[model samples]
Target: EHKRTNMNEAIVEKLHGTLSILRRERDEVHRAKELAMERLRLAKEETERMERTLQASKQKYDALMAQSTNNSNSNSNNNCSNGSDGHGGKVNESVEIMQLKKEVERIGREAKFQHMEYVSKRDTLAKLKNHLKAEDAQRSKNIRIAQETLKKRRAKLANIQALARNHISTDGTSGGSASRGRANDNGNDSGISGGAGKGKNRTSASASAS
Candidate 1:
């Protein structure tokens, strides 16, 4: 009731306009989202199509390779009939023998390389062992040298400590003896002065009496 009487008409009109603008924005956002989803779906379909094409190409390549191998085999067995009469068993046997020869050569090469690698590794291991032994020997020698040096240093320190202690004791005894001697000399001087003072006083009294 209060809003009906007090509210401005222009403000109400402005609010209605703002609501309409907001509704348009909401619809635009929904359309943009739908477009994005559609693009995503199309991208997925394209990826699937590319994958299928790749598979077909791979199959075609395999077929070509197999056909080329068969042709090579057929050409190599020339003594056999040009057609399939004598070429049948001979072509298959030749292909098998060639495959076996290639496999055997590959195996032999691998074995040779493995043997060489083993020898190299063995030599390297031996060298490493020698190096480790040399290092151990040097470390032991250094340890012995360090121990001898430490022993000499300890002996020198002990001698220096003994000398310092003797010097300190001698200084303490000399100081005590000097102090006692000074005290005795001061007592003797005071006694002599007191005797002279008494003799003078006695002589002065005799003169006065006479």
Candidate 2:
């Protein structure tokens, strides 16, 4: 009989130890999830910033292109007027027009390069967005699994407590104090679980806002 009682006590102790370990693991996973969410938020913000920069660069490039065209037209008009005066002026005007053409070509090339850079940034942003979505989905799955595991663990713990109480009562042992202690422990566990739930809700809200 004494051996049986000792074995029952050992079983209860083992259950308690397992529950504590599981709780610690759950906490660690929650922390890791929060870190991943923060990183994803930062990545989204960076992508938005790049998009704004790309838009500004495009506008600047367009303005420079239009100005180049206007300058070329003005130079052409000036050359036509100077052609009525002399051959020397015409030759000088021709050189000036060549220089202007070279400048316009250089500006065009720069605009093309800028556009390519913008396209590259856009592609990078898209990849980052896709990566963030995948991470979010994975994180949600992990959290759901963790919650399910916790629920199962809680159920197991409750069963163990009930069995322990029943065994002690059947043996006519002084188990009231132990039962009360277990109840207090369960209350503490409930509080921890509630806090975890609140944290999860807050995280969800933040993700939605982002």
Candidate 3:
């Protein structure tokens, strides 16, 4: 009877261990399933988010394309209004955009070239103007110097003329005084001769009377 009880106790312990092992395995599997479900849910949410983003990107692209088409149509209409063939109906928007890009580049190049030319011309003009101004200033200085010299020469000439006039007057007076002195001397000699002649005639008359 003791052997039977021991055997029953061992059996009961073995069954309990097996049930505990099974319960642990089942709980592990359930946890694993839950983790898998969570992962799937996260993947689904990410996919939906990506899809929404893609849809939004697509919509934005469509809107931009529509706007570009409208702008291109309007530009074509404007070109046609100006009697242009709007690219001759053979060129699409992309081709026209490329052509426009090339044209813009060409225009930019031309503008740059023109700007450089203008700068060069402006510099040349500035130099010319400076040179002209310098020449003018030099001319002005020369004119002023010439005028000053002329004024000085005129003053000298005037002084010389005054001195010449004074000298001429003084010489004329001296000449006149010398001529008057000579005339006085001649008259004195004539008077003396006349007196001598009268005395001789008187002496002869006295001798005849004696």
Leading candidate by lDDT: 2
Across 1-210, the per-residue lDDT of candidate 2 in tens digits comes to 455546556665665666566566656665765665566556556555655655565565566557656666766787698764345645665565566556556655655565565556556656765765676666666656656665666666666667778877876655666788899999999999999999999999999999
TM-score of each: 0.49, 0.42, 0.50
Point out where model 3 deviates above 4 Å. Answer: 1-91
| lDDT against true structure, model 3 | 0.62
TM match of model 2 to true structure: 0.42
Better of 1 and 2 by TM-score: 1
| lDDT tens readout by residue for model 3, 1-210 | 345445545554554555465456556655655565565555555555555555555565556557668877887788878876555443565565555556555555555555555556556555655665565566556555655655665565556666767878999999999999999999999999999999999999999999
RMSD of 2: 30.0
Candidates' C-alpha lDDT: 0.61, 0.65, 0.62
Model 2, residue 62: C-alpha shift (Å):
0.7
Query: RMSD, each candidate, Å?
Result: 33.8, 30.0, 54.3
Q: Which residue pairs in candidate 2 collide?
A: none
